[model samples]
Target: MNAKSSHPSHNLPSRRTLFTAWLVLMALTVGTMLAGHVTSTRSLGLLWTGGLLLISWAKARTILQVYLNLRAAPRGWQTGFNITLIMLLLLLLGLYAINALGLIPR
Candidate 1:
């Protein structure tokens, strides 16, 4: 490696790749939210919201692992990311459950 490329921390996806992924994620999230408009049920609306959250999580993970080369992340970082992913999933599920139980509005 060259002198300037000696540091692993300096290696990362280009700004263009990051921005492109962000745009794609935003589009998918909006599409997921718009899915509710096709249906009249509150449960469907909640499901759409949860789906969007999960899709966003997946897209973020993909960008991290592939574009950002985070597949080789440090153990701590990997663990923390996994925890955050799980928490997001739990939150999404809880939202759906609450709506399903009639404990919250759609």
Candidate 2:
């Protein structure tokens, strides 16, 4: 049998794929910084905060799929991880919204 067929993690991503993923991640990082206004003292309102959260979710998914090689795992595993990440991000956004709305005291 060929080496690929014999390997358990046979569907590893190619170098080109890795490079592309890296580029996408870098671009998302820049997007996050811009959306969050990292270089400025300005506060990010609800919409910008949501955009930043979405960017972070994308970055996390990319790292999990590409860097951690979770893409080669079973579909159930992928779904589970995705759900977990989504829940976590939702929780963070909820907290941010509450604080921004002055529901919580400083």
Candidate 3:
């Protein structure tokens, strides 16, 4: 069985693991930038927005769980953090949808 880190405060991921995370993070960053460049109709815009939100959620969750060393934490803690991330993303998406639809004053 894998043992815990000898030093309680030393929680850095392995070099290879960190490099993998960096690659994934970079891919997500490029995906987000490309998403903004894609032209779309109003209906397609909603789908595009949803896809962007999902991708952003994935990147943020990965950063929190991997880079922040939250992956080794308890299930409850992980769930809480993930829920918080989802809620934040949902709120942001909702505001964006409203703005895109011109439902409120500019």
Candidate 4:
């Protein structure tokens, strides 16, 4: 309704940007699969887990900043979302570590 609110900076992403993000996500997924398949030894499996964590973190960042339109938000909101994302990812990594260490049934 307001002129300031009708600015082009608030528009949704272009088709090309979304397509490029999708392609990057697909490639990261393939990389995750490859990381899994390449792991033969226990150490390699640990390495694969780290790789998966990084891949997932990147994916989450991409989703939050692009698909969720968090990048254009105010600094506090953006920081809050990023903090939540990091905490959740850390929890996931912790669960994976526990499972890998045989603390729980796989």
Candidate 5:
């Protein structure tokens, strides 16, 4: 097998890959949101949000693990990233729960 960096299987960044991935993700997210609006279904909003979040996260993780090759990143970076992600998720959940319970006027 070729060396890691030189391997065709590698997904390292070269500007083009990053730009294309970003465009595709944005397009997909926008399309989902538009479809949700057109359908007039509240569940569609939830679906759009959940799907976009999942796809966005997967793209970021791939960029980090394959492109940046940060699987071997410093432990502190990994821990910090996870903690930040967790906190953000918790905040979103709290907001959603509050809205669902009608505790907040939305």
Candidate 6:
């Protein structure tokens, strides 16, 4: 490998980038709390639940890419991680749907 490629700073995110990512994660966290109605007794309907799930997916992606430094990984690795995350989220959503439909005993 080249000397430049071996440098630690090569794949590291800058402070500004990390700060921006932090800001985004915080915002998403607030959005999640709001969407999920953490402060209210009201239950979330399907639409709200879906929205919350989407926000959660976004937050997970941000954590994976920025905090975990997956952005610097190979394209195949990135894609694989993303696909796995998506599949897991989809499975959760599917189970929620099935429960919502009364397919399973409460």
Reference-based TM-score of each model: 0.53, 0.87, 0.74, 0.71, 0.44, 0.85
lDDT of each: 0.70, 0.91, 0.81, 0.78, 0.60, 0.87
Instruction: For residues 80-99, write the lDDT of model 6, one tens digit per residue.
Output: 99999889988988878887
Candidate 6 Cα RMSD (Å) = 2.5
Q: How far is candidate 5 from the true structure (C-alpha RMSD, Å)?
A: 7.0
Clashing pairs in model 3? Answer: none
Clashing pairs in 4: none
Residue 89 C-alpha lDDT in model 2: 91
Using TM-score as the measure, name the better of candidate 1 and candidate 2.
2
Q: Judged by lDDT against the true structure, how good is candidate 4?
A: 0.78
Better of 3 and 5 by lDDT: 3
Give the winner by lDDT: 3 or 6.
6
lDDT of 6 at 4: 83
- Candidate 2: residue 15 lDDT (0-100): 98
Model 4 agreement with the true structure over 15-90: per-residue lDDT tens digits: 8888888999999888877776655554544567778778888888888877877776778887898888889878
Q: lDDT of model 3 at residue 26? A: 97
- Candidate 3 Cα outliers beyond 4 Å, as residue runs: 1-11, 38-44, 99-106
Residue 32, model 3: Cα distance from true site in angstroms: 0.5
- Candidates 4 and 5 compared by lDDT, better number: 4
Q: How far is candidate 1 from the true structure (C-alpha RMSD, Å)?
A: 5.0
What is the TM-score of candidate 4?
A: 0.71
**Runs of candidate 6 exceeding 4 Å displacement:** 1-10, 104-106
Clashing pairs in 6: none
Which is the better candidate, 1 or 5, if ranked by lDDT?
1
Q: Tens-digit lDDT track for model 5 on 48-104?
A: 555545555555555565456555666777667766665776577566656556787
Mark the regions of model 5 whose C-alpha exceeds 4 Å error after superposition: 1-40, 43-56
Positional deviation of 101 in candidate 5, in angstroms?
2.8
**Among all windows of ten consecutive residues in candidate 2, which has the lowest summed lDDT?**
1-10
